[model samples]
Target chain A: MEYLSMLPGPTNVPNRVMRAMLAPIINHRSDDFVELYTDVVDKTQQVFQTKNDIVALSASGTGAVEASVINIVKKGDKIIIPVNGEFSGRLAELIEAQGAHVVKLQTPPGQNATFDQVKEAFDNNKDVKAFYVVHNETSTGTMVNYLDRISDLTSRNDSMYIVDSVSILGGVNLPVDKWNIDVCMTGAQKAIAAPPGISPISVSPKAKKYMIANPPPTMYFNLARYFKYYEESKHTPFTPALPLLYAYREALSIMLEEGLEHVFKRHKVCSDALYSSLSAIGLTPFAKQEDRSISIIALNYLDGLEDKIFRDTLADKFKVLVAGGFGNLKGKVFRVGCMGEVNKYHVMRTVSAISSTLAMMGYKTDAQAGLKTAEEKLKAL
Target chain B: MEYLSMLPGPTNVPNRVMRAMLAPIINHRSDDFVELYTDVVDKTQQVFQTKNDIVALSASGTGAVEASVINIVKKGDKIIIPVNGEFSGRLAELIEAQGAHVVKLQTPPGQNATFDQVKEAFDNNKDVKAFYVVHNETSTGTMVNYLDRISDLTSRNDSMYIVDSVSILGGVNLPVDKWNIDVCMTGAQKAIAAPPGISPISVSPKAKKYMIANPPPTMYFNLARYFKYYEESKHTPFTPALPLLYAYREALSIMLEEGLEHVFKRHKVCSDALYSSLSAIGLTPFAKQEDRSISIIALNYLDGLEDKIFRDTLADKFKVLVAGGFGNLKGKVFRVGCMGEVNKYHVMRTVSAISSTLAMMGYKTDAQAGLKTAEEKLKAL
Candidate 1:
């Protein structure tokens, strides 16, 4: 049985993107593959909104995030990472694993790191080599709203500004160049609406120069090799997931064809619909209104509702798959992803499914009210 | 136009395997995903012929090779690697990049590392932490023939035995358990016949214990995280390339369905056919007869035949894509891979294409004779 994927990511891939994987595999070093790779890099740069060099690594989003850290920061260097959600905590761990000193700017779950919090950390740790932040916290359904401001602080301090925009970039209007984000990485499976496995990362000239001078002790995730191969022959240093790349290119094409502004607007409208509709059905939005993510909707379970039973019922009975919160938020909240091809029909069906499921579980829910709210919000799209 | 892929890697994916990727994306943490991941791991073990735990990484073959090195060999640890061709040379580089002292067992191209060469290195480097070797060198189409013997040496020395069987695993018989291989990694695109990207790596208990005791500095390629996730949740530590995992499982299913013995025999027969037929058409096999690989057939270029012109004609006119030699072998030899769903038709067609392309380039070649030789060898299968 096919179920709608409402998780933060691996979001729903379109038929056009999925069908693109069926193309026969080609030699990665051949001219045909070079053309394909070049086209993908070109399209990827447009989506990233940066003139920086872009490379698609055959890895998950986490791999690219790790690459961003290891490629620039040395063993003894100090780096500041803000921690709020599970993904942000992971970012800290990744930096710590590199033997670098990570000054984590701690924030409460459900709240994003404030500009003041980042400024204090940077002031305390004066010799920071880099400042890494998760643009969208998938676990808490929150986003760092002041990234443009944070970039300015990093630029003034001469620290590399790295962003993990895995689940948000395509859904949100993130102009990497305009924000002065030195390094930003996103997954193909998220808002890109491609299959997972390929992470498209954009590296600014500053970051590239640093990496070349102090090369990371890595072979596969080596960004220098990627740049060399891209410059010499438009190809990846190692064999890439060919089918996934094809799907990624097709997904990017679809996003471009629809226009970035329109896609971002669609994500905002759909997510806004989810927030209002779910709220009308007696579910509380977990994150604060100002910090809530536009890509994922985090909603609290009704009183006395079991996490597993609720998610299982929504999946088994209603054929809708959402995700439970991570770490401390596990039993408290469930996340519904509203990115990557999410439309009015998807929002309506998901709202209807959740309300009906709640009603079946003996909860007092106004299903019609929720559907009406969703319809009202979606009409704006 | 659909061309027959005869390259060493990114081999032609079977239709059944390709169709497996068309399944809609599911929640990776769901029971459905767990079952899928568990099934793929189980089938992967069967192909590996080991009771060791297998982890499918969302990386290419090179990434897995890097994992094998970084996970086991620590900084300042002494390691020995046999460098005969491009891949084994890379193995040495990966080990050295970890701040480990590498004692290279140098062997000439087109020649497999002799058992004596490995033994000498082990004797010279008494405190070696690991012994790494490439089972199949894709660049030169040569393979280490005495892996079982080397495994005995590694066992006696109490050093980790790591093998990069990327280009030859499924088509050749190198039982992981029987040979006591501590860590063995292979790619999906080679003998496995799946699309490139996912690498299946098997880890023995010994290797796992050492890794847990002294963890690697890397995060993305961390095997401990993979073990914890697999044991507790039957899932990967991070979001995997879901479609590629599906393709890998289907490819494993196909390989097991064909039976390992039958698959190995098919590979041997096909390579033998290519060797004999190409020789009959006046081409010399690059590797020595005893050390020649059963998966890839490397042959020297005919005199006065331009490398680019010859390969382009073969690809454009005959619609058969093979690979040219790498590094020093470039423009000197060409390679034809005979693995992963490579049957009578592919062999006969490749042989015919090479001969015809040679004849078109004003070199004397017997196209009919090459086809006849391939037909005779294929009749045995």
Candidate 2:
């Protein structure tokens, strides 16, 4: 089967990036390698949209999140987190693991935490050291206005703002510097158009101050040592995934050449086309229309249709892989990602495939009309 | 200039494996992925020569080593470790980080702890929970007779025998069952012919018993969880690196088809050829002859000749990478790896490159003669 990965992670990797990852592994100590590492770091700062100290760790996204927690929050620190989606809830668990107290601002599954709620929590808890939130929740297709609300909350309290932009980073217009985000970190798999191995983290000076003041006595995720090593030697504390770094350098080059604004615009257009097609097929979106993420669009199945059957038909027949609604909404919706290299053509094909698959699975829908409407919307762009 | 990476790891990745690794990013949950991971694990067991529970991790070698330490050793366990080379010392450090006390049996560099020494240490330390040692110390090019020693140590002591085979697995024969090695683990980059990311680890029933009795409180590196997941679902605790696992499957297929015995003999031939050429060129092998590893050859340079300059000449002129010594042996010795996919032909080419580069630097050797001797040695096979 000709399979296309429309899943949230391990997204469509570019051919050039694939080749770059395949390139011969070079000696890490070589001068050529140091130059490569330095170039990647500089380019990463541009992608992150921040002048903060960006350190690349050869770990999964979860590892970087753990590093953020371990570096800034020592034992018994009070941290504020949200329990909106899976990733946010994961942060709460990580905070708990660090032996820290967590004050969770709970919102409904599809809804995001409001600034007023966050403010109330902050006002109630003066000992909070940091605020952790996900900018775009992958489990739900809700895009929080992190820069507008969370930044205000953290700035008012003088606490560190740690944002996980993992699924939305490269595809969204996240001006990290303009937003005053203290710690913005991302994984490579989602909008980065690369393999899932490395995590890119940009630490604000304020966050760095907090990290240095309370450096975790850990070894693998030692942020202070990582900063020293990257700044002084352009290397990591241990042997990194060298091939993945090469892949990142290539992926970043392509991303920068396309410009961040163009990438963001593309994601919005593709996602809009997908949403339009779903609407044409009489399917409602899971999240509020205004808060739908540009990179991922979640479509709720009609009353009689099952999401698993719809997804299985798409995968087994059309070979278009997409994300199933996670957790509470498990069989209710399917998510189609328009991030990274996913463009208008892909969006149209996905819409057509879903429409046809739904029809084959005994759901009433004019499959061609969904595809035609999607194409028209995309062409009007 | 030709360059050689002789420093322990990020060892030379073969072009075939690198090309294999250049595949498109794959979805970890896909059924196609199940086949890849199963193949990788099955082949890894073949390399370890055991039917133990083998699991692959999407982290560096140290990360897996950390997994071993945290999985087996709880907070108050005592470990008996051989502190001969840098890697074994690292094992002790990892164990100590778990709040365990290490009883070290120290041996000098270029030497291995004798069986009597290990047994005596275990005999003296009645509370020892585990005994850790590196089968091949890449830092010192010293290969121990761990197989002959581990069986007696663990069979009677009721203690785990954990072998760090990071630099030696697949390059040498590791009979885990015959050797009674409770746990044997290795990384991808060393002699596995794959780029580094995943660490392959196999554990025996005895090690499983220890884990069941004392489970580490950590969630990430939980071995029992991994075993449950693999035994029941044939999956990992978290999302595994699909691409690296694919590379491992292919590399292992090649290794097995080539025959393990043939592969070991080839490594011996390459190592001996390189060692002979170094001797002919008036350089001394760093490791004692009786205990020298057949995978990596460490050579001492002539007095007053900086090892970096010689390494630079090799890299710049020949496009070959040799390793420079680390820590105490820096600037004094160069390491030439004969491990993994490296064969006699590669050794001949490297030896010729070394002799030619040295001759140009006025080191007085017939480059063509050294090349001829190395070629003759290979032709004899």
**Candidate 2, after superposition: displacement of residue B339 in Å?**
1.0
**How do the residues A51-164 of candidate 1 rate in per-residue lDDT, one tens digit apiece?**
999989999999998888788777788998889888899888878887788888888888977888889888887788889999999999998888888876887788989999
What does the lDDT come to for candidate 2?
0.78
lDDT of 1 by residue, B268-369 (tens): 899889999999888999998889999988999877777899899999999999899898899999999988999988998888888888888888788888
Q: Evaluate candidate 2 and give its CAPRI docking class based on DockQ.
A: acceptable
Candidate 2 residues A184-217, lDDT tens each?
Answer: 8888878988788888899998888777776653
TM-score, model 2 to reference: 0.94
Point out where model 1 deviates above 4 Å. none
- Write the residue-wise lDDT of candidate 2 on B23-103 in tens digits: 666666556677777887888888889999887877777777877887887677888888777778777877887788888
